[model samples]
Target chain A: MSRSTRIMMSVIYWAFVVYVFVPLILMIMMGFKDSKFIGFPIKSWTFDWYLAVFSDTEVLTVFGYSTAIALLSTVVSLFVGTWIAVLLADRKFFGRAVMFGLMVLPALVPGIISAIAFRIYARVLGIEPGMFAIIWSHAVHNVPFVCLVVMARLSTLPKSQREAAQDLGADPLVTFVRITLPYLRPALIGASVFCMLLSFDDFVRSFFLGGYQPTLPVLIFAKLRSGMSPEINAISTVVLILTAFLGIWAERSMRRMKKET
Target chain B: MTSDAPTQGAAAGTAAAAGPRSLWSSLARSQPYQKFVDVLFASQRRSFLILLLPPIIWVLSQHLGPIVQMVSVSFTDAYPRPPGQEAKFTFDNYLLFFREPVYMMPFMRTLIYAVVLTFTTLIIVYPVAYFLARHVKRENRMALLLLLLIPFWVGEIVRTFAIMILLGNTGAVNLILKSLGLIDRPIPFMYTGFSVSVGIIYLTALYMLMPLYSALEKIPASYTEAAADLGAGAWTRFRRVTLPLTYEGIGSGATLVFLISTGYYGTPVLLGGPNTTVFAETIAGFFHVAGDKWPTGAAFACIMFLASLALTGAFLSGMNRLSKGGRK
Candidate 1:
């Protein structure tokens, strides 16, 4: 940690940051550009493209589809993952490590592999490969993630509190509802938000399960493959803004937790 | 979405229970109902089952099920067979895959792509993660990590498009190169192995960096401080103290990047040309786009599956050996 080395590293870090941010800036910039093809150094800025982005029925419908998928998956994960976390935290069992490994396989496995598996599984189950399959596919992925978050939050609360509640004549259900659920509120909210975004932004599984309708990412992918258009840039910019806001909110909430603790 | 340590359910009986489950509260407190009381009071067994089953089924369905089916489908013929002609389940497709020679080049090139991309990403990311975890201000560490995560937040398809825009003939990169007189014309940057590798390294650097950063951050500063106090230089400290501590994380990170990169369809398809497509894209094409030949596509996928499984197994063992060595 010599001063010279530190300065050099800082310079390098800045370069990396610029490399990451520049493209995003360009995307947003192109969204506002009035040009035949997207290029650097904008000439005439206009909202016509952004207007087109919103007005297009296909985009709007896909946007709705994406939102619905995200929302449904998040809700499912919150409830099911909470129960799973509760079960794990409450018991001593054989094969604990193995069970835990299985829990996390979806997160580590590539999306393409999961998508392939889902496609086959849906066919076998006679489930139509459509929006339901897409949402369920996302839920399978999101549950583990949401459970991990909720479980972490649950771990922070002292065991003594819940044990004491039970000892004081509170039933197990009562103890869970009154003592446990309240403490997990923040985590529930955060994990839900995380799940929602994971579903909304996903493209891989959606691509496999897209029967008659496309999700937002699928729409963007199709549009990009067809031809480079500024409208897709507009959509990307919008998604980027939403993601940035989510990131900030998450961090701020985490900081608030640290302060309270 | 990827975490190894999660809180268990034993704690949740105390955590999630609210009021009693039934009207037997008074009876539940009585000595006669002590068994139910003990079960309710001791939230161990039920919690374990509840926490484990759903995700197990979910993952099995999503990860293992298709793979099994894919393996089954690959053994059959590609052409339309009669209703009962698909029974023998031979290894003909796999044998054909080897004998065809069409898949040979792409398969070999994919190996090179994974190795080159893994090395390139590791080379770039190690220093970046090291600096962020060690040298940055405490407040800035999280912000910097957030920056690392931003590109991932934007879907890969969009990022690919962005790369195309930058590297295409009339794109910003070429425009800059032309204006600088660095090149006579815009080289084929958009649909080549070069761009494919670059795009992959960009896409996966974060996954590799996060684990490495976590490992680095967990290493006690005191160890390195002790090294420096003993007159060891920075490079010596990095090699002796920092590197050893991060062996497990490095192994996990490298395995992740390598395995995913091998089966990649997005980067290769978007950035690579007809000559440079990867195995996954070919498999996908045969199934969905080319002619709906699921059997051949499944065959291709099975080859990739086995290859990836072998690679992951080797990585796991190698990492274990390294971790053992580092422990000394």
Candidate 2:
């Protein structure tokens, strides 16, 4: 590459990076501003808003509620997704193509469309809008990701391992528990964290289905509607720190596990 | 089967003589339980069914079932009909969309915005993806990509709030411009089409970047080097070789960005003015009102869904044809 072209590319790359981080940095900065308003030229700073996030009962409850829902949905999706992946991993199967399409259809549908559909379906089933309804929608939404991830991991498994287990008189269930499950540990952990983050960050579904209590994103939406506040920024900063940490951890561990195997 | 019956009878007799130590333990050790376990794994077909049944039921009931229900609701006269009323079928719900310019305009605007924004995101993100995948050292690429992705991990509402902070009257943009003497007064950037577009591009750019980066990364260095040896200019080399090779990535990235942009409810609501209302807000407006209008919302949602799917299908096929032609 020419020197001028290389310089141009580097400049563009750094500009994009600045564009990505400027808003985020401003958000974090606004969180520490002492005044009620959100703006530049902060004459004072304080930690009161960040402290308020922990001391406020309502915010704390919403955090616990969102975490509970994320955990429940993640566990359910992992179970269903792993089952489907195992079934589809066979070399030749009838209707495999059709089944795979069906598996992926949910993830392709837009969030609003699916959320509306689930709202209607929940009413039809006499399931009132509440925690159960939210969990059901989140798990269904997350299953495809889990299935895809687990299936990718399963594809790399050596066939002879299973055959060897069978040669030693292990039953199908035993062999699966001892051999297949162990092999899928890294993928399962990765998919679980991904699902948790997805479910926790989900807004449309939770907003549509939630009743009296709101999840974290829905609560943030409510706060936004009232108007922007330093408290909202503090809450956002905390969430950003948390999810970034979890995501980085998952990526590093998955890469390390892949190398080990 | 016949032999198992006698064994089961003996086990029951033995349990009776054991003074009822524990009914659960006795039953677990019984012949019938063993037989059931044996039958489950007796054939590969049986095991396959055991694995396949749950996902099939789940997909049918949870995934496809709700969508099918939505379609049915869209055709109905009313939903949540008062206690005992039957659901009468009608096309009026869908007809409402075609007749009202208020509804139709936003729907059209949504399609246009989605296409334009998807293209814009592709243009803005392509060079950066190229830089990372082709120019940067492979060892540093992953760390840089992760840094870029951290902002996306936060929820939509939080990120939208960030945009609101950046564009408000007293926001960073206005403050900086004022300080620099570029303007004496703050510019109103919030609640505009520009704001909404910027927010959507910010949110959906990652979708485009991932696919394009992977596609660019997969291109062999030899092809570009060979083109260089043949004395092709930089622009010609890119147009003929790199762009054609990344068509699959472009197609996928465009599809994801388009679909996501079309379905956005929160960002548009937060950043857009009344004039810039998108189709998702229009559909959501119906659900926010009386229950009687929910059918109308379902119908509108279905229209958006089918239209987006059709456009993407066409775009993908066009990309496929172009890629094939380029190869020839």
Candidate 3:
């Protein structure tokens, strides 16, 4: 590239980066503001907001509840998704395309539409709106992601490994448990973390399907509707830090696993 | 009779001699159970069934089931029907959307915004994606991409709140502008179409970037170099070589951004003014009301869903044709 073009590209790239970070930096800064109102010209900075978030029992309870929901939904999605991935990864089967389409349909449907659908469907099934309902919706939504990730990993598995296991007189179940599952460990871990984040971050479904209690995202939305506050900022910053750490770790570990193999 | 008696006698003797421990072991090692296990594992079809059944049931009952229910509900007169009230199937629920311009306005506005913002996001993100994919060192690309991805890890509400803080009346934008002598007063940036668009683009830009970057990254450097050597200018080389190769990426990213923008409820609700309401907020409005209005909401949602899917379908096919034509 020419020098002027190179310079222009650098400028554009940096400008975009600045655009991406400004809001986030502002968010983090607002968390430390002494005032309740969210705006510029910070008169004083304090950790009182963060301290308040840590001390608030309601917030702490919501945090634990959301974590439990994420964990439960992730486990369910991983189990079903890994099963589907294994099934699809096998040599071409009847209705494979149709099944794969059905499997991925949840991911394609808009969040609001699906959230509403789940709400209506839960009523039909006589499933009350609560933790189980939210987890069910989340798991269904997350299955497509888990299945796709696991399938990607499964595609890289060599056929020889399974064949060798079978030749050694291992049953299909044993071969799967001993040979295939181990190979899928990295993908499972990655998908689990991703699913946890997705389920935790989910707001629309949790909002519609929830009864009285709220997920973290729903809580933030409630607080936002009441109006923006430094408390919301502080809570958001805490979530941001956690998810960022988890995301980076998952990425690094996934890359390392790939390298090691 | 003699052979049966001797075997029976031995069984009784062993059972009596060995007591409960031997009896349990013998039962476990019995021929019938062993045969059952052998038969179960002997057939590939059986194993396949075992593996496929759970997912099939889940997809049918959980994934497709709710959508089917929504479709059914959309056709009915009312949902969660009042006591002793029968659900009358009618086309009226869907007719409500066409009959009232109130609903139609936001629906149309949503499609327009989605299309425009998708294109805008493409334009804004394409250069950044290209820069990262081609200009940056390979060793540094992943790190930079991760940095961009951090903001997206937080949920929609948090990110929208970020935008609010940035563009509120006394926000950073106004303060900066004032200090720089750009304006004497705050521009009322919050709760405007401009803010909503900005927020949507910020939220969905990562979706656009990933595909574009991957597409750009896969292009061999030699192709562009060879085009240049053939006396093609920069624009021509890029148009002829790079753009065609990344058409798939562009299609995917555009589709994702468009669909996401159309369905976004939180950002638009948070940032948009009364004049800037999107279809999702309108659809949500129905559910927020009495249960009798749910069917109307369902119908509206179905319309939006079908329209968005159809538009993206057409766009993708057109993109495919364009890329093919470019090759010829």
Q: In order, how many clashes per candidate?
A: 29, 0, 0
Q: Per-residue lDDT tens digits of candidate 2, residues A13-76?
A: 8899898889989999999999998888899999999999889999999999999999999999
Over 4 Å off, model 1 = A251-261, B1-63, B76-87, B289-292
Query: Would you give me the overall lDDT of model 1?
Result: 0.76
Query: What TM-score is obtained by chain A of candidate 3?
Result: 0.97
Q: Native contacts recovered by candidate 3, as a share? A: 0.72
- By summed lDDT, the worst window of 10 consecutive residues in model 1 chain A runs over A251-260
RMSD of each: 7.4, 6.7, 7.1
Minimum summed lDDT over a 10-residue window in model 3 chain B is located at B20-29
- TM-score per model over all chains: 0.87, 0.93, 0.93
lDDT of each: 0.76, 0.90, 0.90
Best by DockQ: 2
> Model 2 — interface RMS deviation?
1.5
> What stretches of model 3 exceed 4 Å from their correct place?
A258-261, B1-39
Model 2 chain B poorest ten-residue lDDT run? B20-29
State the lDDT of candidate 1 residue by residue for A21-96, as single tens digits: 7666767777888975776657798998889988988888888888999999888878878876776665566766
Indicate whether candidate 1 or candidate 3 has the larger lDDT: 3
* I-RMSD for candidate 1: 3.0
